[model samples]
Target: MEEIRPDENTKPLTWKQYLVIASLLFGLFFGAGNLIFPVHLGQLAGAKWLAATAGFLVTAVLLPLLAVLAISVSHAKGIYDIGRPLGRKFALAFMVLIHLTLGPLFATPRTASISFSVGLQPVLPAKLAQPCLLVFSAIFFILAFIISYQETTILDSVGRVLNPIFLLLLFVVFLLAAAKPMGAAHQQTVTAAYHNMAFFNGFLQGYNTMDALAGLAFGYTIVSAVKQLGKTSAKSNAKVTASAGVIATGAIGLIYIALIWLGATTLKHFKPSAEGGTAFNQIVTYYLGDFGHALLATLVTLTCLTTAVGLLAAFAQDFHRSFSKISYHTWLAIMTFASFVTANFGLDTIIAWSTPMLMFLYPIAIVLIVLSIAKTAFAGDPVVYFWAIGLTMIPALLDMLASFPPVISQSPWAHFIKELQVRLLPLAAIGLDWVIPAAVGIAAGLLVHFYRKRPKQ
Candidate 1:
C-alpha cells in the first residue's frame, strides 16, 4: 500500500474528479432517512415551512458540512482519530458504536426496507408483498456487497453512473410536481408536536437523517477517494475534500428545498402520513399515476443501493484496519449478511429500534463535531473534550430514556426520571435538554484549562 504523506508533492484534482467525489459523497449521505424526513417535515410544518426548513438545514446540512471540513482540515484518518482527544479506550468504543449504528444496526438495513416498502410494495400484488420483500432485500444486500467488495472502484462505479441516474429520475418527479402544481400551499392543520415550536420540532426531526454521523464515518473514504484521484499531500487532500463537500452541499441543499416544497404544496391535495415513505409514494402517484411507480422504484432502489455500498465499504475498511487479524472481505461479508437479515424485520421495527439509540448518540456526535472544529480555542486540551462530552452525556442519556417505548417508559423508575428531567432541565420538552449542560461544561472546561496554564503569580 502506498502511504499518503503530509509533505508529498501532489497535483490537485480536476473539476471532473471533484464532481465525481462530490456525487459519491452525496449519494452516501442521501439514503432512506434523507429522502423521507424532509418531505414529511414540509408536510407537517405546512405554513411554517420556511422557518422549519431553516432549522432542518442547520443540523442536516450545516453541521454535516462542518463535520466533513473538520475531518479534512485535521487530516484525521477516520472517526476514531476525531475522538482521540477523549482517550484511546473512548475513541475505540465511540468509533465502534458509530460504525455499528451507521452500518448493519440501523442504516444499512433501512436502505433495503425503506425502498421495498415505499417503492415496491405499492406496485406489487398484495400476496406477493411479503415474499417479494424477502427477495428484494436479499437482492439489494447482494448487490451492495458486490459493489463494496471492490473498495477501490466505489467512487467510479457509484459516483460516475448510479447517482446521476437517481438524480435524473428524482428531477422528473420534482419537475412534474412543479409544473402540475398540487393545489396551493395551504396552512393545513399540523400535529400537536408541530403546532408550537415547529422550528425546534424541525431541528429534532433532522436528527433522524443521521447525515452528520455519516459525514464523519465517510471522511476517511472521501480522503481515500481523493488520494485515488492523485492528491496525496495533506493540503491537497483537504482542498479536494472541501471542494467536493461544497458540491455535495449544493446538490443536497437544492434537493431538500425541492422536496420540502413538494410536500408543502401537495398537502392541500393529500393528507399527511406518519411515514414519509407513504407520503412520498402518494405524491409520486398523484403526478405520474401508475407509471410513476416504476420511476420511483428505480430511483429508490438505486439511491438505497449506493448508500448501502458506501456504508458497508467504509465500515469494513475501518474495522479491518483496526483489527488486522480480520480481513476486509470477511468484515464486508459479515456486514452484508447482518444487514440482509435485519432488513427482514422491516422498516417500522428498525426505525423503532434505532430511534432510541440515535437520540442518545446524536447529541454526543454534535458536541464532538463542534469541539473538533474549535479544538484550537482550547489548545486541543483533552480536558475540554472530557468535560464537554461527560456533561453532555447526562442529558443525552435522559433524552434516550424519554424516547423509550411504553414498556420502558411505563416503569416507575423511568417515570420518575422523566418527570425529574422535564422539571429540572431546560429545553427538555423539545429534546434539547443537553444544550445548557454542554455550554456549562465548555465554559467550565475553558476556565480550568486557562487557569492551569496561567503564568506564575
Candidate 2:
C-alpha cells in the first residue's frame, strides 16, 4: 500500500517505473486464451495471415487500448462509470454481467482450464489428465487467492517478477521458432468461414480472446496503479495510464504476431486441428522436443495465473466495495471456490458455453466503450448512451441466438428468427448485426439531443 512518490523537483516516475507498470498491464491482459486463439487463426488462415491479423488487431489490440484510454480519460472509477451515462440500474446490471463473464462464469475458470489442457494435459498420461486437471485447478485458484488477498501489492507482484518470467519464456519460444523454421509457410486452403472475408472472420475470431472485456475490467486497476505511483491528478493519471497502455499494446501485438506466424508454419508439417491447444502443443514439442513441453507448460501457467489473479482481485475489490458487509477476503474466497468448480468443467465446455454469452456481452461493451470515449462529441449526453445501447441489443440478441447450440438455433422458431435477422439486419452473417442499428441509434440520439437544446423559434 505504500505510494511511491518522487521528489517535487524530480519526474513523476523514471523510465524503469513506466516499464514495470506496462509489464504489469501486459501480464494482466495476456492470458491462456491469448495463446490459443491467434495460433488457431494462423492455422486456419494459412496464406491470408496478414489480412486476418490486421483485422484481429482491430478488436484484440486497438479496442483494448482504447478501452484503457477511455477509462483513464473519462476519469471513471471503474467499469460502472463507462455504463453510468446509460442509467444507474443499467450501469449496475451491465457491470455485474461483465464482471461475472470475466470472472467465475467464464474467463477466470478458462485460464485454469486452458493451462491444464494445453500445458499440462499434453504431458500427462491419458487416464491421469482429468485427475491432474482437478489437482492443478485447486492449486491454481489457491495461488490466485493468496496473491489477490493482499490487493495493494498486486501490481508490483505481477509487474516485477511474474510478468518478466512469462515474457522471457514466451520470447524464447518465439525466437527459437523464428530462427529455425518448422516448415515452409505453404498456402493451405482457407477454411470455409475465412474463404473470402478473412479479415472479418478474423475480427469475429478476436472476440474469443476476451481481452477487450478485460480491458474494461482492468481499467480501474491500471488507473489505481498509476495513482499508487504518485500520478494523482486526473490529467497526469490519464497520461501515465495511456502510456502504460501503449507499452502493453506493443508487447502484446508483437507476441500475437509471433504466435500467429508460429501457428502458420506448423501447417506445412501438420494439418489444422480442431483444438488450438493440440496444435500449439505439437509446435512446441516439435521445436524444442520434450524440453519445450515443460517450458510451454510453465509459460501457460504463469500467464494464466497472472490473469486469474488480476481478475479475482478486481472482482473481489469491486464487489466488496459495492457491498461493504461482505469483506474482500470473503469475496475472494467465494470467487476462488466458484472458479475452481467452474474450471473443473474443462476448457472446451467452458469455451463452448461461454461463446454465446460473450457474443451478447461484447457488442454492448464495445458500444459503451466507443460512446464513453466519444462523450465530448455528443456533449456528454446520457440519452446517446441509452439509445445506442438499447438499439444495439436487438441485433446482439440475434447474434446470441445465432451462436446458440443446434438444439436451440436449429429449432423452427429459432430458424424463423434467424432468417428474419439475416434478411433485415446488415452484417448478420458476419456476427456484427449490431453495427448499423447502433449507428442509427447514435444519429437519432444526437438529433434528439440537439433538438432538445435548440433555442426557441
Candidate 3:
C-alpha cells in the first residue's frame, strides 16, 4: 500500500480488500428490482434482446459505474460535495433529490412490494393475497427499520449470506432454463428503431434503480474500507474503486443477462404484459412448478428485505445527520410509515408513476457522470457546472409535467409543448427536451471561459 494522507478519517485497504468492499456494495445495489426489470424488458424486447440488453446495461450498469468513478475521483464525502461546484444551494437540492429518489418516495417501498410478490405470494391463497401483502409489508418494514438504525458489521455479514445465495439460486434457475429452453424465442420482429429505442428505454428504466445515486453515496464507504486496509492514496483509491466496480458489475451483469435470456425464451410461451414482476413470477411457475415458486419466493424476499433495510437505514442516518432536531428513532419511524404507505401502491403502480421522475433525473445524472469522468476539461469552471445544471433542470421539470400521457393530454399546456416539440430538433431526436439547452449552455460556458482567459491585459 502507498503512504497517503494520514487523516484520522482516512483508513487504508489493499486492492484485494477494495474488491471485497466493492462486491459488498454491488450486493447492496442489486435488489429485487434489478432481478425483475430485465426479465420484463427481455420479454417485450423479443427478438431484440441484444438491443434491450445493451440499453439496459447503459443506465443499469454503465451509468452506475460512472457514478462510482465520480465519487472516487472527486473524493466527495457525499452527493452534495460532488455538486458543490454549482453552489451550496444547488448541492443541497441535488442531495435532497437523490435521497428522496432512493429513499421512501420510491426505492424503499419498491423493495417491500417486489419482495412480497416474489417471496410470500407463492404460498398465499389467491383470495388472501391482498391481505397477505399488507401483513407482509408491515412485518418486512419493521425488520428493515431495526436493521437500518445504525452503521454496523451486520451489513458485511448479510452481504456474505445473501450475495452467494442470490447468485447460486439464480445460477440454478438459469441453468435449468438453458437445460430446458422455454420452447423457442420468437422470430425477431421488432424494427431497428424499436431495437434502438429499447436501449434508451432501458437507460431510462435504470434510473428507477437509483444505483447511480447510490454509487455516489456509497463510494466513500468503499474508500474507508480500503483505507482501513492501509491503501488510502488517490491512485490506490481509484484502483480499488475500479476493481470493485468491475467485480460488482460483472456479478450483477451475469445475473441480468441470464434473467433477460430466460425472459426472451419465455416470449415463445407467454404473452406480453405490463407488470414485469408478475410476468416473471408466471414464467418461474411454468418452468419449475411449485418448487420453482418456493425458490423464487425465498430469493426475492431475501433480496428485497435486505435492500429495504439497507435503504431505510441509509436514509434515516443521512437525514438525521443532515438535520439534527429530529431524533434518529423518530426519523426512522416516520420513514417507515411513509414507505409503508407507498409500498401499498404496488409494483405496477410504482413503475408507472416513476417514469416521469426518471425521465427528468436521468439526463442530469448522465451529465454529472460524464463531467465527473471528464473533469480535466472543465477544471475549475464553476460557470460550466452552473450553466449545465441549469440547462438540465429545464427538461427535468418538463418531464415531470409530461410524465403521464393522460395528464399531459388534458393539461392546458399540452399545445404549447407540442409546438415547442416541433421546433426542437434534439427533443424530436430523443424526446429530450433539454438537448438544445445543454448544447447552448456548453457553448456559453466555453465563451465565458475564453472571455475571462483572453489576455486580462
Candidate 4:
C-alpha cells in the first residue's frame, strides 16, 4: 500500500484508487434518467440511431467529462467558484439556479419518478398507478435521506455496493440484447421528427440526463473522495480527477450505446412510447418477463437512491456554504422533502416541464464550462465572463420559450417572441440560437481583454 500524505503534493492515484473514484463517479451520474432518455432516443431515431447516438455521446458523455475538468483545472470547489469571475451576486444566483434544477425542483425528484415509471408502473393496474406512485416516491426519498445523512459513506455506498450491482444487472440486459437483437435498427423507420435533424435533436435529447450539471455539482464529492485516497495537491487532484472522469464516462458511454441500440431494436416488437420509461419497460419485459420487472425495479431503485443521495449531499453542501444560517442536516431534510413532493407529480409531467428549463440552463452551462476550461488562455478575465454569459442569457431564455409546449408557445405574445428569436438568431429552430451570441460575446470580451493588456506603448 502507498502512503498518501495530506497537505503536500502527491503522486497520481494508483489504478486501484482511480477505479474507486471512477466507480463512485459513474454511480453518481448513472441513475434512472440516464437509462430512460437514451432508450427513448433510440426509439425516436430508429434507423438514424447511429448518428443520434454520436450526438448523444457528445453532450451526455463528453460535456460532463469537460465539466469536471473545468472544476479541477480552475481549482473551483463548486459551481459558484466556476462562475466567480462574473462577480458575487451573479455567481451566487448561478449556483442557486443550478442547485435548484439539479436538486429538489427537477433532477432529484426525477430519480424517484424514473424508478417508479419504468420499473413499477408497467406492472400495476391503471387505477392503482397514481396512488402507488405516491407511496413509491415517499419510500424512495426517505431512503435517500437516511443514506445521505452520513455523507462520509458516499464512496463506499455508491462505488463499492450500488455501482457494482447496477453494472451487473445492466450487463445481463446488454448481453441478452447483443446475443439476440430483436430487429435490425437500420431497417426500422425513422420517426418524422428525426428524419431531417436526428443528430442535433439527439444532442438536445441528452440534456435530460442532467449529467453535465451533475458533473459540476459532484466535483466536491469527487475531489473529497480523491483526497480521502491521499492525492492532495491541486495539480495532482486535477490530473486524477480527469483520469477517473474518463474511465467513468467511458463506461457510461458504452452503456448508453447499448441502451439506445436496445431501444432501436425493440421497435420490431413494441410501438413508440411517449416517455422513454415506457420504451424501457417494453424492452426489459420482452427479455425477462415478470422476473425482469422485479430486477428492473431493484436496479432503478438502487441507482436512483445513490443519485438522490449525491444530489442531496451536494445541495446541502453548497447551500450550507452560501447560507450558514442553516445546518447541513437541516438543508438535507429540506431538499429531501421538496424532492418527495415533486416526484409525486409523476414521470411524464416531470419530463415535460423539465424540457424548457434544461434548454434554458444547458447553453449557459456549456459556455461556462468551456470558458472556465480555457480561463488560462484568456487570463481569467472578468470582462470575458460577463460578456459571454450575459449575452448567452437572452438567447438561452428564448430557447426555453421556444421549447415550451404549443399551449404556451402558441400564445400571441409567446409566438411573437419566438418569431423574433427565430429571425434574430442563427440555429433557432435547432435550439442552439445561443451559440452565435455566445461566440460574439466571447469575441467582444477578448477584444476588451487584449485592449486592456496591450503594453502601454
Best by TM-score: 4
On the 0 to 100 scale, the lDDT of residue 31 in model 4 is 72
| TM-score for each model | 0.90, 0.91, 0.90, 0.93
Candidate 2 steric clashes: 0
Write model 4 residue lDDT over 138-253, tens digit each, in one string: 88888889888876675454556656676787788788888889999998879987888888998999999988988887766787787777767566777788889899999899
lDDT tens readout by residue for model 1, 353-393: 78788888889988888887787688779888888899999
- Per-model C-alpha lDDT, please? 0.81, 0.82, 0.73, 0.85
Task: Give the Å error, residue 85, model 3.
Answer: 1.5
Candidate 3: RMSD over Cα atoms? 3.4
- Model 3 residue 237 CA deviation (Å) reads 1.3
Model number with the top lDDT: 4
Order of models, best TM-score first: 4, 2, 1, 3
Candidate 4: regions farther than 4 A off: 1-12, 150-155, 227-235
List model 2 lDDT by residue over 116-148, tens digit each: 887878767988988889999999998888888
Question: What is the Cα-based TM-score of model 2?
Answer: 0.91
